[model samples]
Target chain A: MFKKTILLKDTSFSPEDKTRDVFTRCLDYLREKQLEQDIQVVRVADSGVYGQGLVMKVLPDATLYVNLKDEDVTRVIDAAAQNKTIEGLALKKAPKQIRIVLRNCGKIDPESLEEYIATGGYVGLKKALLELTPDKVIEEMKKAGLRGRGGAGYPTWMKWKFARQVVADQKFVICNADEGDPGAYMDRSVLEGDPHSVIEGLIIAAYAVGASKGYFYIRAEYPLAVERIQKAIDQANAAGLLGKNILGSAFSLDLEIRLGAGAFVCGEETALIASIEGRRGTPRPRPPYPSVKGLWDKPTVINNVETLSNVSFILLKGSEQFASIGTEKSKGTKVFAVTGKVKNSGLVEVPMGITLREIVYDIGGGTISGKAVKAVQTGGPSGGVIPVDALDTQVDYENLQKLGSIMGSGGMIVMDEEDCMVDIAKFYLGFCVDESCGKCAPCRIGGYQMLEVLKRVANGQAKLEDMTVLRRISQAMQKASLCGLGQTAANPVLSTMKYFESEYKQHIENKKCPAGKCSALSNYAIIQEKCKRCSLCQKNCPVEAIPGSREDGFTIVQEKCIKCGRCLEVCKFKAVSKT
Target chain B: MDKLTPEAIDRIFKQNRQQSANWIKVGMSTCGIAAGADEVYATLVEEIKKRNIQVTVKKCGCLGMCHAEPLVEVCVDGMPTVIYGRVNKEIAVKILDKHVNSKALLNDYIFDLETK
Candidate 1:
């Protein structure tokens, strides 16, 4: 067996990589000392930590040495050889990815009830059932300061407490697993990975609220998540962790699965309740809220999948420990589904108040195209774009809200220099318009008018006054919409307009798409200086847009050119220019 | 698989506190499956059984590094536990042949994370 494994990387900003240099030096020294056989040196791609120049991690020991100079290299090698840590050089990295909601994920076999239980899965429910009273469970939740992770960030304890205090014949609890955000899949992963944790949390919620029945409203699109959750529910029933007299306790809660017919609007609490009640999945105005009047007009509590997942974790690992992880207000970690232009797109669970710069740059490993990050879009279609300048701000409910984003279900899509803000706004606004339930006229008509105005703006057919019209529609939608869907649907348009006004102005005044993303506003042309007189563009155009011979140097027929971007794609000489 | 009471939960957790030795876990979540982790899992299981390898293969969930899907984490008796990312069927066989049986870590596929 190898005595030491030295993992080295030159994580410096300079052009030269010193990882190989250090590796050679360490290898030479080890060989000279006749200890090469005992130690193995390997160059690795990612060391999890970044920008800490010439980083070396001695594996098995995991002793990390950062900012290594030539002199410190020898000392680090010696320390690794002796299984010792050099004093000042070794940094005990506080773990970056804190797995709380995802604690059982990727570790235990999700299908195995035994595996989940072995990982201290339902102990939280056990604690809530046997030791703590309903009031005490609510108290513990209040102490934990946990909030709804389904974008709104409402206090979870408050929802449970309100549902608990209501004097109703029968109460209901619903787990909103109808996650429909375009790029977000955190809830699906949790449901698929550790369904027992969620089942336990939902059981705890049922017990705390004195509810006799519960439902898992999962989207039909997530067949795997549904299967895993169904399996987990079955396993829990067999183990007495779910259904009647759970774990031999007095609390008898029956759990069932409700499949969402792929409606994005059903993610809203009221719409989800309607879907569950076998009615049209549309939102009704809130006065009694879901806590007082929900599903069959019985007092009910609706918790998000991630929020319920956190419940079991918060209870299992004490409220105080959960409270200690994040910001003062937003306790515990929040999972974000980072996608789009990001190098490493995945679900990352991090403590609240962690900077967006750290999330995008450090955790995500920067943009995939290596382009300068233009802005990061958080909260999906219902959220807004955060300019690269504002990326340094900490991520929490309040902070993201202040940044004009709501942390909507933790879908963090990164945008680079090539992404046009106007186009992005139009794309998201279009999604909302398509998904609009039409129950409320404000969301239906207002979203359509706003999208039309955005379309005109993108096509360079709108005046600067259209911007005012867009803002007017946005304000009307936010104020008069029936539910959260209509209320926040204008967020993307408003946010992109707010942060990237100059890009929008360029389209209106200069009639130029700065990012060249709006094809209508920009036209492609073959540069005479760059063109190699090749008939490639002419041969590739479907409409036969180009009319000239290869020897005569072909040029695009402007009137015939359909702007299909085929010529640009077929051109290997980099001759095609979009202007 | 009897209905577990409070006592049984404690006993299971106590038993699991000490991790099982010589196991390979493949990420079998949707993201992993989309990237063909299921094939990797099947290959490992089939090959391990065929070769009569002592290592136990198990299916797990996504570890959040989506760019490197079909990830497999291997832990043997003496070697350091390492996660091999972007693994395919070939890599699965190679992992079994080199990493597990021979106890030598593979080159150019380790995606270790501590934190940023």
Candidate 2:
């Protein structure tokens, strides 16, 4: 058996991989020293470090060495064989990701309550029930500085305190699992990976607020999550964790699951409460917020899946430990479902103060297409786009809001150069328009009007005055919208226009999409010099836009051209040009 | 099982704290299952049983690496615990034979994700 393992990868972007060459050289050196059996050499798909030259990580003790040459291979192998470190070559990369909410995600069996307990799960609830009072629990939350992860970063302690102070005979707690963001699946992963944690959080929230009943408002779209949560609730009930006299404490709470019909607006707390009440899912004005009046006209505390997960951790490990991580205002880690144009599209739980650059490059492995990243779209439709220049800004509740983006449900979508800014704004605005409940005019009519103007801009038919009209309408919607959905619907348009104003100007003035994404603004033509007269473009054009024989040479008829890009895709000699 | 008191919870926690050192965990969440983790899990179970390998195969949830799913984590004595990504039936067999039985780490498949 090998005493030590060395994993190698050619991290260079060159077409020819040098992993094999490095591996062979290392193997030969090990053999020469008669240490082949002692040291194991292996090639890896991803060495966790990118853009460096050939990279190798020595295992049993993961000491990474990067930018390696063939000569360095022997030194790396020799160092590993002796379990010694090479001074200049040994690279120590501190991990960018820290899992708090996702602590037991891959560690224990989520379905098994015993495994969860073994991993220090539900211990938080036990402590909350046995040692801490309702006010003490709120104090711990306040000390932890935990905030709601559902777009609006409200203080969790204040929400519980408000509900606790209200003189009501019947109070309720709801776990907002109705995650409706387009690219965000952080909640679903947590619910599926560790359902007990969320349940424990909910029970603790119920205990803290003196509520006897709680509900899990989950979207029906997430069947797996729903199933897992249901199983977990049953297990908790069986173990006397969910039913009356939970952990033999007087704070007994009954929990139930409510399925959403997959409406995006229902993710809002008021709308979620409305949906649970068997009413139309639409947001109402806040003042007598959900903490004061919610679900059947009773004081209710609504916490997000992530927020509750943090609560369990904070209660288990003291408030100081949870508060120690992240920025001052936003404590603990935030889980982001990093999707769209990213190399590794998955759930990443990172501390609040980590930079977007570190999350995108170090954690996400950069963009998938190997193109330059233009911007990152955070906070879903309610949030805004953060330009690449501002990517170095530390990610937190206040910092993201300062960048004109809310940390909305942690749906961070990375946009590369090929993604059109105007088109992206239009897409997000269109999603809001479609999901608008038509209750308030600001969201219903204003969202539709903004979408119409954005469509005109994308089609290259809008005048310069239309940009002003779009802004005016966006401001009106932001000011007058009755609910969070309408109020923040214009965020995408406002933010994209704020950072990518030049791209919009290009679309309006030059009638060109800089990203070449808007088909209506794009025109295709056959480069006469480059064309081989092979009739390939002519044969592939579905609209019959290209008409001419091989001898005559094909030409694209502009009027008939659908701009489908089929000719561009089928062209062999780089004859078809799109501008 | 009855309603667990605080003392009972502590006892259970202590009792289940000591886990088997030699075991294989397959990511069985939606992301992993969608990426064919179920097949990889079945293959590992069958192969280990067929080979009579002294290892336990179990199912867990996603480790946040969805891009390289069907993730299988193997931990055996003398071998460092490693998570292998994009695992299939063939890799499962190789893991049982080479990694489990012979104690050699597989190259190119280990996803070095920092989950601390």
Candidate 3:
């Protein structure tokens, strides 16, 4: 049995890996010293550290040694064998991630209510029901500074307080699980991983607002999440946690799941309420907000999956603990579904004040293609793009909003150099255009027109005046749209145009796509000097754009090429070039 | 199975706190299942039964490391609890054979995430 383990990784950018070489050398040295059985040496895919030549982490201790040389293998093995540390080589590592929302994600059996309870799961609800009054519960939320995580950062306590103060016989709480962001899955993960937590949070919210009924507005697309939440509700009902007289307190609430038909606009509060009410899922103006008039004309409190998840923890651990984490205004950790061009793409829960750089590099392990990250797209279509130069900006409600991006639903998509800004803006704008309910003309018509202009820009057919037209239309849509969906639909275009206007200028003036992504603006050609005259490009071109024999080197016919990139992909000698 | 009172919740919490000393938890959420954690989980259970290993195999949810799905966390008496990622049937067998039986940690498979 080995007493200690050493995880080794060749973190060098070189294509050639040195982990095997170093592993063998360490094994041989340990075997020669008759300590092979005492120390275990292993090669890892990622050592959690990057760009350093070679990294060796000794565990149980987790002392990382970076830029290790071949001779240092003996010293590492020796240190492990003797249970000592090499002061000069040892490196201290601070944890870059904190898990509050995902606290019991991998720890307990989610299917078993007993396991969740054992891990202090429903204890928050128990405390809320037994000790705290409705006002006290709202007070705790206010002290915790918890905010809604459904793209909008409204204070959770204020939403509950408004619903509580309203003189209504019937009030409701809805857990917004209708996550429709392109790359965000934080809600789905939480609901699937720990359904009870969200349920507990919902129950806590229901209790705080004096509501007897609650609903989970989940998208039908997330079958797994829906199934898990259904099971959780059933379990809670069985355990007397859901239906009538919950925890033997007078505050009894019934919770049910409502499936959304995969409409993006239905994620809005008013639209969600409309969907639940069997009405057409379209948004109306908010003044008498959902807290005052919502869901069958009754006061309702809508909290996001992430927001409710924080409620249970805050009630259980006290407001101080929850408030202590994150920036002053934004308390507790925010879970982000970090995806798109990232190396370690997954769900990361970080404190609110953590920098985007730390989240992208330290936690995400940088981009997947080993290319520098160009920008990060946050808040889905409603949010904006944050350029790489501003990566040091702290992440919070105000900070992201100040950076022209809302903290929408916590979808942080890391984009590398190959991703064209104009193309990305067009993709998000197109999503909003397709999802527009057509109730409001600004979102219905404005989104379509903006997308049309973006298409023209992408196709390299737009004039310099078109940029001004795009901005003018975006402002009009932002100001005239009746609902949040239409109001924020232009955010992606506005943000991309703000940060990447030069790329748009390149597309408009030079008729060139800097990222080589927009096929409409791309031109493909055969580099005559590099071509081997092997007929490979000619044989592979589906359009027969490359026409010539092996003797007479192939040339690309530009009009027939279609810019499919098949020739570029099939070319062996790097003969095909795209501009 | 009745409506839990505050006292009952406390009792259940206390009773559940005393977890078994040796167990293996497989992440079984959508992300984990998509990455074939169900197969890995089945293999671990069957292999443990076939070998009559004194270890318990259970299912849990994703640990936020969706990239390293099919994560298998092993916790045995006198062994440091560690999560092995990208696990499959073969690795499950190796885990039971080498790590569980001989008390040796697998080298490259352990994913040491800083979740503190």
Candidate 4:
């Protein structure tokens, strides 16, 4: 039998990689010692540790050694082979992520109800049904301290408790899977990967609030998730996990799937309830929140897919266990769809209070192009930007808000130096404008007007007074918009103007895009010193903007140039430059 | 077909949790499928069955590693569990032939996360 295995990776941010050569030498030394078979040396793609040279994990034993040298390999092998560990070389990396909601994701077969049950999946629902009353369940949730994983970190227990306290003949529970946030797909993955977990959570939630029915408000964009969830519901019904008398208990609940017609505003609970009730997917005033007067004029509990998934785990493992992991205010893990300019762009379920630097550098493997990360955009279009300097800030509800950004949804978009702050703001603002439901005057008109002002700034046509106009409109939208979409429409612009005001000023006053992202403000030309006078630029110019001959030395016509930078690609001597 | 009692549910849960000595799970989520996981899954089943390997081939959801799409995780009783990424038909077969059947590690595909 294989006794031990050593997985090696170079997690060094240092310029040189000495992993392979050093590993080979160590392998050779081990072979010379006739211990090649004793300790299996495997080179891994990632060791979940970054910027530490020559990372090696001795598995079965799991004695991690970092910053190794030529001499340290033999000692590592000897100790690892003997089932012993060296003290100094052992790496004790604090896990950047703490998974509760994603506990079954990639661990169990998503489609297999049996596999889910075996992993103690439905035990939470079982416990909630057999042991706890509705009040008791709410009490446990209150202890666990789980806020919604959806944009607003509202207390989960409060929503349930309020709905439970209300005397409604018919109550409902809705899983808000209408995840339309830019760069966020956490809900989709949870639904597709562990459909049972979310299902079980929803069932427990229904029982806790005395709801007879639950509806999954999933978006039409997620076809596969829809398919998986449908299969799961079918399996649950077949297995008598749903319908009348669930798991041989009187706490019976009926579940259905309601597909959202891909509306961004409908992700809001009020708008989602409106959509479910067959009304136009727009938000009304929220004094009578969903918990008070929801679908069909009855009390309703709307929870994000991730939040419900946590319910089961908290029940199965106990609320204290769940609450112990995260920060004081936010007491659970948050799943971030880490995308854009990051090396490891994926879903990362990190506990609250973990530093943003740890999430981006340790878990995400830093920026994709190896450039210094400029900022991280969390909560999508509705969220504000966090500059690189504040990366060490703990990622909790309050911390993110303190940085002038809300943890809108779990979309954490990494931005490098090449990503112009103004350009980034424009992109998000444009998305909000496009997705705005146009129901409220402030959101409808304010969003369009803000977009126009941003466009003017981007086109190098705006004066500095436009900044005040942007602030004024942002304040109006923030205070007056009906739903989250309209209210946070100005987030991107306001954030960029706050953090990178100089960049915005540069675009307005000097008519220059420092990152050369804004095409109207950018100038494209060939650097005469570096030009090799290659005719490839002239041949490849789409608009015939480069008008000079190879003999006369190629030059870009400033008037005719569309700033497409075609010459930049064709130049072999690195001649073409854009600024 | 029958209303599951609490005892029955417990029994079913117990019966389903099978302990496998060795296995390979491919992330078959939409993100994984879009990145050509279907082909990889089919190849692994075919190759493992053809080779008469004892390792159970299974489908799982996204492990949150979307950038490294088409992720294939291998766990042998003897060796460390590793997630090999960018897997195709060839790598599927290689995993079955080399990682499962042989002792040597496959070149440049192994990703070892701290499995707890």
**What lDDT does candidate 4 reach at residue B93?**
85
Query: Model 4, stretches more than 4 Å misplaced?
Result: B14-18, B114-116
| Tens digits of lDDT, candidate 1, A143-250 | 999999998999999999999999999999999999988899999999988888899899999999999999999999999999999988888888888777888889
TM-score of 3: 0.97
* Per-residue lDDT over B83-104 for candidate 1, one digit per residue giving the tens place of the 0 to 100 score: 8888999999999999898777
Cα lDDT, model 3, residue B25: 95
The TM-score measured for candidate 2 stands at: 0.98
In candidate 2, residue A163 scores what lDDT?
95
DockQ of all candidates, in order?
A: 0.70, 0.73, 0.66, 0.68
Top candidate, metric TM-score:
2
Kindly indicate the candidate among 1 and 2 with the higher TM-score. Answer: 2
Distance (Å) between predicted and true CA of B110, model 2? 1.9
Q: Which ten residues in a row have the lowest lDDT in candidate 2 chain A?
A: A42-51
Docking quality class, candidate 4: medium
Query: How far off is residue A245 in model 4, in Å?
Result: 1.2
Error of 4 at A44 (Å): 1.8
Q: Rank the candidate models, highest lDDT first.
A: 2, 3, 1, 4
Give the better candidate number (2 or 4) by lDDT: 2
TM-score list, all predictions:
0.96, 0.98, 0.97, 0.97
Candidate 3 lDDT tens digits, A290-372: 99999988999999998888888888799999999999888888999999999888888998999999999988988989999
The C-alpha stretches of model 1 lying farther than 4 A from their native spots are A12-29, A51-53, A67-75, A88-92
Clashes of each: 1, 1, 0, 0
How high is the DockQ of candidate 2? 0.73
